[model samples]
Target: MNSRIVLGAFALTALVACKEKENKNIVEEIIEIEEVQPTTYAEISVKEGGSWKEGTREYIDGSFVNVDEMEVPEQHTDHSWYIRYEGPGWENKQTAYRLYLDWRNAIDIFGKKVDTLVLPYVGTDGFDSYHNEAPWGQDILKAGQSMGIGGYGRFTGDTIAHFNEVEKTHVKVDNSNSSSSVTIDYKGWKTGDVTTDLESVISIFPEDRFLKAELTPSVSFDGLATGIVKFDDIPLMQETSETGEWAYIATYGVQTLAGENDKLGMAIFYKTDEAKAIEGPHDHLVVFNPSTKTQTYYINSAWDQEKGGIKSEEAFKKDLQTKLSELDNNGKLE
Candidate 1:
């Protein structure tokens, strides 16, 4: 009788344990991570572990894991200038920005969708025919940034010098990941005689209104300015950190798609404990006194017609405040 009782209790305990295990299994089956969705694919300039001679590339599905690729978009060229245009030249489904490798340290703007440029345009060559529809964004940022639209420049305590500021190295790109990015190599750009060794990685996404600039310098450098062309007619609106570690500058007024008399907002953003003072150089400059070798900043724009936000000065300022907060919150769900 005693042995039978002991066996019955053992059986009861086993049954309970089994039932608990079964319930746990059911809960696990209900919880699973959904896979991420794929966006537009990328096929970048030949500069990525390849030769520069190739002009365009066909889109390969997993060929690029990132949504932003270079080769997939329409690219205008001045091949009449070079054998191969190994531009850090890049365009997304919505916008275009290219490196004038032969021109200067400047990055030229090609604002519209490449498809739009397919239409007719100005002065033809010796052939007297319409050459190509010019880049609608046309270098809207004229001496705005000598390094050519965010390229590094030497602040000679006077005028900025960008000529021969970057490495002769061909532009290198990485579109392999789901997000497309381009890198321009520089040992360090010189201003007068001061040279800071650093390489810049610029990455962009399909839905992003801005691109991020990741700068790695071999040594600490200061007073680097990221700016835009200043028009006496357009008003500049911005704010600086009381602590001098962060800054935001923007111009909202007559700047627009193709520089027409429409509304556009161009801005630069940076944050670091090393920032010293923000000043208006030839155009606009956010000065930073570096405490570390790695620095990150952002440059972007919004066209009242393209992106659906902040057309008025009041709205634009509010958006900037919100963006700063979002960045501060580690990109939280707020």
Candidate 2:
């Protein structure tokens, strides 16, 4: 009886030791995952600590402060200087992007050199500091009079009508460990004769240079389009995925604002069925079919100066093809 009791006690002791070891292993694994997890960021900042010029469209004498949501003041327009970076900015490890948030309503890319969150630090030094090349990156695209890459507007035959006549504009931002997004609500957006409300959600994931835009218009009308900005001597490239479910409109050449020699590639991926036509006179446009339902599309860019980035047109095309295949196989790019 004494021997049996001693053996039972020894067995219990061994079992407890084994359980403790297992628990310790799990704790270590959790710590490892927490340390290496990716991060994404999004934010909108406005001038504070100063007063808005009374009866004028100006914000004077204040520093920028980050905000979660904002109602665009009635007197805002391009280079108004009230909003930092001129609008909401978002970024993942690969790249960063921002919208004009004013009459231009155009999208722009911020080429990144490091693989970390940098949007919060951007434009903090000054409004125009980002235009020049820095250690992180620079405002690489010259949008000009076009919808900077994947920015939407109403196609009115010979012209693309931007958000020039919106009654009000509201913007909100969301950020998480896995993704970051900006939601813009345009109330009473007037383009030509048609007036409708629009909600544009632009989101970026933790691993890629592509940002997804999901547009939902309150009323259905024709000629809703998104496109890449046009540049001289840079030819547009278009192709359908192997599965034929996805297609892309792209351009690659010495087009970045960084310099005449700096190469940048921009592309828009859309569902083949949702696209009504691919037309271009001002910008490389992808006109979507008329519907009240939410329409989805993606905008991507690659800068030659980025760390481990695509340097050649051939590699850019190859990377786009891989993304197409991923989209075709999984119904989404992971």
Candidate 3:
């Protein structure tokens, strides 16, 4: 009875969510820009040797805002924290991933100054394919991936966190291309060993004003109650609606603590945005080793329709094998 009620509520939410039409003026809704000025560029220093092409505009509060579109240089790597001095330096005003003032203490921990840290920030927002997860979703209030690190904006009152006894912070600045981005490598910290974690809502590409489809890729505390375990390989399909646009997304990739290594795989799919009705054949595949629990989602991005779908599952398997071998060689897999 409890399961049935949960399913009923879930179904109702899904129905209600799909009922609303997508307003075409999505940009107008999110960017609260009073005036749309021509783009310009600024050079800002991010401590971890990461450089960004950022832009600034005066916000309603009269503070200059770094238009949140900073682009990290393609070659920039080597740090996990990012910080940018948009208006000026830390003493003036800046934004960061983890900032702490034991300044030298931060250097000892993150191997750099506490002021110029860069954290990885990847969002699949705005794009039709990646609009409902992580960087794009409100549900990502905290890390699906956690650490011994805790507390943000604690002492000294900046966007900083003290982790592993290290104080950290971030900053963002304008880049040369008139765009904005930050850089931080996915280093430091193990894969973690907690047996179970929960992702209440998963989204790939999220909008601040829309209810996107939610998915639970891994077995979750909630998904398990209904006997739906091991949902890690589901493809995020782009299906078309009657309203003349392709919609629907599944985001959030959770993993059982024990099944983390078994849950490795890639997603293969087409990059085109062509619309397809509900009855269209599958355009993606997720090949996996059920025993080992490794899987990859493959999308048919080629123009050659004949070489797509499960017909190419064998090829995908070979690819997965090669990847696994490499990972094993690197001693990255458990």
On lDDT, the leading prediction is 2
Between candidates 2 and 3, the one scoring higher on lDDT is: 2
Which is better, 1 or 3, measured by TM-score?
Answer: 1
lDDT of 3 by residue, 1-334 (tens): 1101221243444444444536435344323232222122222323432234344211111211223323333323223123222111111001111212112111100111112112222111221111122222111112121110111111111122222222122223323222222221111211122122112111111101111111122321111110011143544433322332222222223322222331212222211132111211221111111121211111111010111222243454444344334333542211
Across residues 61-131, which tens digit of lDDT does each residue of candidate 1 receive?
21112112232122323342221222444444444455544325555444443423211121112111222
For all candidates in order, the CA lDDT equals: 0.48, 0.85, 0.22
Per-residue error for 5 in candidate 1, Å, reads 74
Candidate 1 deviant stretches above 4 angstroms: 1-80, 83-86, 90-94, 113-149, 165-167, 240-245, 256-260, 307-310, 331-334
Worst 10 residues of 2 by lDDT: 1-10
Model 3's lDDT to the true fold? 0.22
Residues 1-334, candidate 2, lDDT per residue (tens digit)?
A: 1101221243454445556665556545545544544467788888888867778777788998778888999988877789989998878888899999998889999999998767767888887899988999899988888999989999988989998899999999887666878999999999988999999999988887999899999999999999999988999899899879999999999998888689999999999999854666769999988899999998999999988899999999999999899889887764
Cα RMSD, each candidate:
15.2, 10.8, 22.7
Deviation in Å, model 1, residue 145 alpha carbon: 6.5
Q: In model 2, what lDDT does residue 139 have?
A: 93
The global Cα lDDT (0 to 1) of model 2 is 0.85
Residue 81 shift from truth in candidate 3, angstroms: 4.4
